[model samples]
Target: MKLIGSSTSPYVRKVRIVMAEKKLDYRFDEESPWTQDSKVSESNPLGKVPCLVMEGGEAVFDSRVIVEYLDTLSPVGKLIPSTGRERVEVKTWESLADGVIDAGVLARLEATWPDRKESERSQAWIDRQTGKIRLGLAAMSRGLGDKPYCSGIHMSLSDIAVGCALAWLAFRFPEIDWRTDYPNLARLHDKLMQRASFAETQPR
Candidate 1:
C-alpha cells in the first residue's frame, strides 16, 4: 500500500497517525497536489492529498475513508467504535475536528498568494476561517475539559483528527497562540505527541 500526501497537510497526518497506531506498514509517497505534475488526479478525481492506494490498484481518498478502512485491517488499536450510539458520537467528534482542518486549509490556501493586492486579498474571509478555528478550539476544549482523550475513554479517530488539526493550525498560524489560550487542547496535543506516531507525523 502507498499513502500519498504532503508533509504540511493535517488530513494526511491524521491518516498517518491511524496507520501507525494500527501497526499497518505501507509506503509513503509525499507529493503536493498543488504541483502541476502531481499524480493526485490520477487516483482521486477530486485531486486531494492523503490518497491510500492498495496493492491491487484500489485507491481510497479522503482521510476519513482511509482511516476507517485501516481500522478494519487490525484490531491492535481500533480508532472507531464498532456499533451503537458510541460510534455515532465518535463520528460526530471526527466531523467537528475535520471542520477545523477545512477552515484552516481554506485560509492558508488563500494566504498562499502573498503578492496579491490588498483588494484582491480578503482579510474578512481569512478572519471567518480563523474565527471557525477559534470556535472549534473552544468547543473541543470545553467538551474535553479533564479528559485525556477526546472520546473520554480511549484514543479514537476524534483524537487523531483534533490533534492533527490543532498542530496544523499552530504551524500555519503561530500568532494565534493556541497552546496558551486553550490549556486543555495544549495538554491533549502534548499527550498525543508522546506516541511515536504523532511525533513522527508532525508537520514541518
Candidate 2:
C-alpha cells in the first residue's frame, strides 16, 4: 500500500500518525495536489492529498476514510469504536477537528490568490471560521478537562484528529494563541505528542 500526500498537510499527517500508531507498513509517495506534477488527480477524482492506494490498484481518498480503513487493519489499538453511541461521539469529534482544518485551508487558499485584494476578501468569512475554531477549542477543552484523551481514557481517532488540527493551527497561525486560551487542549496535545506515532508524524 502507498499513501500519497505532502508533508505539510494536516490531513495527511493525521493519516500518517494513524499508520504509525497501528504499525502499518506502507510507502509514502510525497505529492501535493497543488503541484502540476502531482499524480493525485489520477488517484482521486477530487484531486486531493492523503489518497491511499491499495496493492490491487484501488484508491481510497479522504483522510477520514483512510484512517478508518487503517484502524480496521489492527484489532489491538482500534482508533475508532466499532458500534453504538461511542462511535458517533468519536465521529463527531473528528468532524469538528476536520472543520478546523477546512476553515484554515480555505482561508489560506483565498489569501494565496495574487489578485486577491485584502479589502475585497470577505473578512466576515474569515472571522466566522475563526469563531468556529475558537468555539471548537472551548468545547474540546471543557469536554477533555483532565482526561488524557478525547473520547475516553484511552487514545482514539478523536484525539488524533483534534491534535493534528490543533498542531496545524499552531504551525500556520501562531497568532491565534490557542494554548493561552485553552489549557486543557494544550495539555491534551502535550500528552498526545508523547506517543511515538505523533512524534514521528508531525507536519513539516
Candidate 3:
C-alpha cells in the first residue's frame, strides 16, 4: 500500500499514526493537493490528501474510511470497536475531532489564500470558523472529563483523531490557546504525544 499525502495535513497524520499503532507497513508518497502538479485528484475526486492505494490498484480516500479499513487488516491494536454502542461512541468522537479540524483548515485558508484580494477576505467567516473550533474543543473537554482515553479505557480511534486535531491547531493556529482553555484536553494531548506513533508523525 502507498499513502499519498503531505505531512502537514492532520487527516494524513491521523492515518499514519493508526498504521504505526497497528504495526502495518506501507510506502509514504508525500503529495500536497494544493500544488499545481499534484496527482491527488487522480486518486481522490475530491482532491484530498491521505489517499491510500492498495496492492491491486484500488484507491481508498478519506482518513476515516482508510483508518477503519486498516484496523480490520490486523489485530495488533484495535482502535475501533467491532460492534455495539461503543463503536458509535468512538466514531462520534472521531467526527467531532474532524469537524474541529475542518473548521481550522477553513479558517486558515480564509486568512491566507494568496490569490484573494485583501478587500474580499471576510473576517466574519474566519471568526465563525474559529468560533466553531472553540465550541468543539469545549464539547470535547466536557465529553472527555478525566478519562485517559476518549472512548474507552484504552486508546481508540477517538484518541488518535483528537490528538491529530489538537496538534494541527497548535501547528496552524498558535493564537488559539486550546491548551490553556481546556486542561483536560491538554492532558490527553500530552499523553498521546508521549507515544512513539504520535511523536513520529508530528507535523512539520
Candidate 4:
C-alpha cells in the first residue's frame, strides 16, 4: 500500500495519523496536487491528495474514506464508533473540523494571489470564514468541556479531525492565537500531541 499526499495538508495529516494509530505499514508518496509535477492525477481522477493505493492497484481518495478504510484494518484503537448515535456524533464533529480547515485553506490561497486586486480580496469574505472558524471552535470547546476526547473517553475520528484542524491553523495562521481564546482546545491539543500518531504525523 502507498499514501499519496503532501506533508502540509491537514487532510493528508489526518490519514497519516489514522495509519499510525492502526500500525499499518505502507509507503508514503509526498507530492502536492497543486504542484506542476504532481502524479496524483494518475491515481485519483479528482486529483486530490491523500490518495491511498492498495496493493491490488485500487486507489481510495478523500480523507474520510481513507480513514474509515484504515479503521477496518485494526480491532484495537478504533478511531470511529461501531454503531449508534456515537457514530453520527463523531461524524458531525469531523464535518465541523473539516469545515474550519476548508475556510482556513481558502483564505490561505486567496492571500497568495499576487495579481488579485484589493477589491477582489474581499475582506468581508475572509472575515465571514474566520467567524465560522471561531464559532466552530467555541462549539467544540463546549461539547468537549472536561472530556479527554471529542466524542467520549477514548480518542475517535473527531479527535483526529479536530487535531488536524488545529495543526493546520497553527501552521498557516500563527498570529490567530486560537489557543489563547480556546483553552480547552489547547489542552486537548496538548494531550493529543503526546500520542505517537499526532507527534509523528505533525505538519511540516
TM per model? 0.95, 0.94, 0.98, 0.95
The numbered model that scores best in lDDT is 3
Tell me the tens digit of each residue's lDDT in model 1 across 1-204. Answer: 999999888999899899999999999998998887998889988999889999999899988889889999998998899999888988888899999889888888677765676578777899999999889888988888898888876898889888988898888889888899899899899999999999998988
* lDDT-superior candidate, 1 or 4: 4
| lDDT score for residue 108 of model 4 | 71
lDDT of 2: 0.88
lDDT of each: 0.89, 0.88, 0.95, 0.89
Q: Write the per-residue lDDT of candidate 3 for residues 1-204, one digit (tens) a residue.
A: 999999999999999999999999999999999988999999889999899999999999999999999999998999999999999999999999999999999998998989898999999999999999999999999999988888868999999999999999999999989999999999999999999999999997
Candidate 3, 33: how far from true, in Å? Answer: 0.5
Name the lDDT value of residue 23 in candidate 2: 87
lDDT of 2 at 20: 88
Clashing pairs in 4: none
